[model samples]
Target: MVLVFLMVNAYRELTPIVISGRTIPLKTIRKAVFIFCFALTLILISIFLILFNQGNESSFLKVLFEVTSAFGTVGLTTGIAPHLSTFAGLVIILIMFIGRVGPLTMMVSFGFRKTRAIPQYPEEDIAVG
Candidate 1:
């Protein structure tokens, strides 16, 4: 749910907004991208940590649900949280804290400031696998 909302909000932010025959420039698109990526990374890490700590005790889907719920601060659980390892429980608690404080807020609080001047260099075509 929260992940869906983050993706939707990011899409909306990336899209240009028009009002009264004028298109509003989106300067925060990078910020939106950063937030989305950070959230995704957190979710993935949480899932990995829980799965590693729990071993085969819980299914992937259940771990995913628990992590997402914690990240969303929705307080929804599948009754697996209590049985999770201490480290896994801590991970969920951290996720909940980050979710409540918000990714952007966490980034800003951690000294991620936006620069006023954006440096642009010449585009180069590179090969990729």
Candidate 2:
């Protein structure tokens, strides 16, 4: 569910962007991606809360520790990484991929349009500190 949301939102953000062709505003794409990533973080937090509630035998801190480690794709945890269920591990893997590649690359693979480069003005010197 979260993966799907991320994929779709990323597509929406990156699809219409073109440097040579002015189709959609770049600012619009940036804002949408920002909001989508924010929402994804919130969704992951909500999932963590639910998992902790269901696995009440574990301490809240432990649950948070494991969840954070999993979602961050850090592969680090308080000795709980080996204990996760197969389904949970798969979720972690998917989340890790998403976190690593991010929404931009995901969208670029499918939604982007390719075109030949256009010539641009030559660079001018500017003072540097």
- Give the residue spans of candidate 1 off by over 4 A: 1-24, 112-119, 123-129
Put down candidate 2 lDDT per residue, 1-129, tens digits, no spaces.
Answer: 334444665677645444444455656666576647754674466457546545754556765666656556677877755676666556556666765776556666767687889999999968765
TM-score of each model, paired residue for residue: 0.73, 0.44
Residue 95 of candidate 2: its Cα lDDT? 61
Q: Which lDDT value does model 2 have at 52?
A: 52
Question: What RMSD does model 1 have?
Answer: 5.2
The reply for model 2, stretches above 4 Å from the true place, is 1-39, 42-54, 57-60, 107-129
Q: Report RMSD (Å) for each prediction in the order shown.
A: 5.2, 13.9
> 1-129, model 1: which lDDT tens digit per residue?
334444665577644445455654455546666788899999999899889889999999999999999999998999998899899999999999999999999988888667698899999968755
Report the backbone clash tally of model 2. Answer: 0
Please state the error at residue 29 of candidate 2 in Å: 8.1
What TM-score, to 2 decimals, does candidate 2 have?
0.44
lDDT of 2: 0.60
Instruction: Indicate which candidate wins on TM-score.
Output: 1
